[model samples]
Target: MTAASPRIPSPLLLGVGLMLVAFNLRPALTTVGPLLAAIRMGTGLGTTGAAVLTMLPVLFLGIASVLGPRVSRWIGPDRGILLASAVVAAGLSLRALGGLVPLFAGACVAALGIGLAGVLIPGLVKREFPGQAGLMTGLYTMTLCLGAAAGAGLTVPLQDLFGGSWALALAAWALPAVLGTLAWAPFARPSRAPVAARSEVTRPVVWRSPLAWQVTGFMGLQSSLAYIMFGWVPLILHDRGLSAVDAGFVAALMSVGQAPAALLVPTFAARLRDQRGAALAIIGLTLATYLLVVFGPLWLVVPATLGHGFGLGGCFGLGLTIIVLRVRDAAGAAALSAMAQGVGYTIASLGPLGFGLAHEIGGGWVLPSTLFCALSLGAAAFSLGAGRNRQV
Candidate 1:
């Protein structure tokens, strides 16, 4: 008789757990931008220092992508995810425990936590919800968008609630971290015997295909643009005469805008012959956002931000779907994911750097918006090439 397949967690429980995990993903990166004034004032950090805090979590995320598979080898995937969640709890808690130096340390730990878990979740959807990859991917992504929105919107008010201490607001996220870890305890246990290798696992030979780099390049470029929005968009808006709260609202609105497209984009992308059309639609929307940011009427802010939210949100799921769809199987996909995330995140880290330098030189948001428009167009062009049926 055939051995029974291991029963995955219940669909509802799995979905809830996924949402909690997803919620943890954005707080480390997005929270600071919303509370930049508080953080800068409280910590006495200059713009460069604040930017490092913003960029390092993402940079470490890329680093964790390269490290995740080895981690998976040590612990079974489920147990590995549990371990990563524990890291999240530990990492976020680090910020609560100390001063400025510890804050950056916590960000790095949190980035590593977010990065490793970020890489694994797609694989989990493939392994546990194989028949429903499309649905699960969309759901997880939407929850991620929601979590990002929560962190973006809540950071300021939370600071106010706790007598204007940013650290307390930052620490408050630990509650979710603990809850998610507890809810995920069952799958946290390792299940399989380790595969013994007679020798060290060699680096798998890579197929140096243009398509591979193109796929990775798409991720890198899109993420570069996304991080600029995350890191500085609110501040830029505030400079243009919006109040700090209004700017935060706009930034939060941009993230919330993505929820609809994030949920719906993957379904269509999964059904498509390739991801080109969906990617083009999203980038095209980004171009529109640039137009509004640069020269549209004042009333256009809402629509432009909404388009940005939807496009960027949809792009996240579509990008992940492309990685899965383009690869032949799980191992190849994992390897490609590692490459894409590592390279992509490294490239993306340039965004905030570029924005700051550009603003310093040009003295306003105008030039930066133009530069991003060009990047958006470039993203559209590359997405067309990456979204092919051939293996990347």
Candidate 2:
């Protein structure tokens, strides 16, 4: 028998692939925020009522996640990302061209695109760079957060680039989506080992694992907090007398700050015996920041902003990193990622709705702030459970 020729893998190409995949993940969901004003005017949406619209993309992350593994099984992880990227472009196109119904519908569709690719790309890192999972995940995740920041920060400018039509603004995002999708076109032929090529496996043990719930719960609660920041922080700042632009800058800072945390937290998680101290510190800071943003004196904004930004980055990164680290192997890691992110994002959508309701019910920031504090405390309780040294 002839010996198989040696294969060469380019870290450069792989790194580029990782960044492209990460770039497409956030624009679908977060780009809405910077353009919320236009969307509100176009659709006649109020804050509390807009939750359905806001939540759709976030909620469907779970829905997309449900479809990811099946996609990887058929197409393999790398190819699956390409498919998802195209879906993102399609969804963004749909978002740009359609009216109100189309707008919300497109959001869900774009979310679906993000959702599948979201689950698969992490699996790609695990598959392609088996020896350097932590470093790869960190780099990939930092790109993801940076994409989020860019989407949020640039939406208005992008919209203005085309004579300021909301439709045009919304559609403007599709260009990047198309670019990223095209950029990831290489490595589409299929990997050597498809997920289904292995023996059929049922992981009821994962279902039975307490650590699974901890991971899921931590992912869910922290995600809720982060989404609240995404969906409402600007509004809160506006309430406190900043213009929409200023509030947006604050929100953008939080999203951007997530980059550092995404880069560092995975390394930290890898080193720690248990992640409890890290989790507690982040949770406490998040709580304190929320207090300052909602109820603290005006001068406290600077520190609160930093604390908020730092907490968000670490919490978001560490949550995903934990899922990957806690699992035993690539299969297990992929499964944990699917379960944590699928359910986690679905549950996270509740934060915006809850915050909106609190504002409606109490007629001021006090009630909403109190409500968030309670939620943050609940997250802290779960983090304690999740941070233990255990396998998912």
Q: Give candidate 1's whole-model lDDT.
A: 0.76
- When summed lDDT is taken over every stretch of 10 residues in candidate 1, the lowest stretch is 194-203
Candidate with maximal lDDT: 2
TM-score per model over all chains: 0.91, 0.93
Q: Tens-digit lDDT track for model 2 on 1-392?
A: 98664354587887886688787788666777766766788678876666666777778888888777788788777788888888888888886675787788788888898888878876677667777777777787788878877777777777678777676777677888888888888767666654534522235666677788788889888888887777777677777887656666666777777788788987787678888888888888888888888788978775687678778878877787787778656667777778877888888878777877887788788887777788777777777877788776
Error of 2 at 201 (Å): 7.3
- True lDDT of residue 130, candidate 2: 72
Give the clashing pairs for model 1: none
Worst 10 residues of 2 by lDDT: 194-203
Task: Count clashing pairs, candidate 2.
Answer: 0
Per-model C-alpha RMSD: 3.1, 2.3
Instruction: For residues 1-392, write the lDDT of model 1, one tens digit per residue.
Output: 98775665677887787777787787777777877766777778877776676677778888988787788777766776787888887888887765788788988898888778877777667666676777778888888888778877788788889887788788788778878888787666554433223212122533376777787789878877778788887787677677767777888888898788878998788888888988998888877885685467768887788788888888888888877777655555666677777777887777776776676668777777777877777777779878888674
TM-score for predicted model 1 compared with the true structure: 0.91
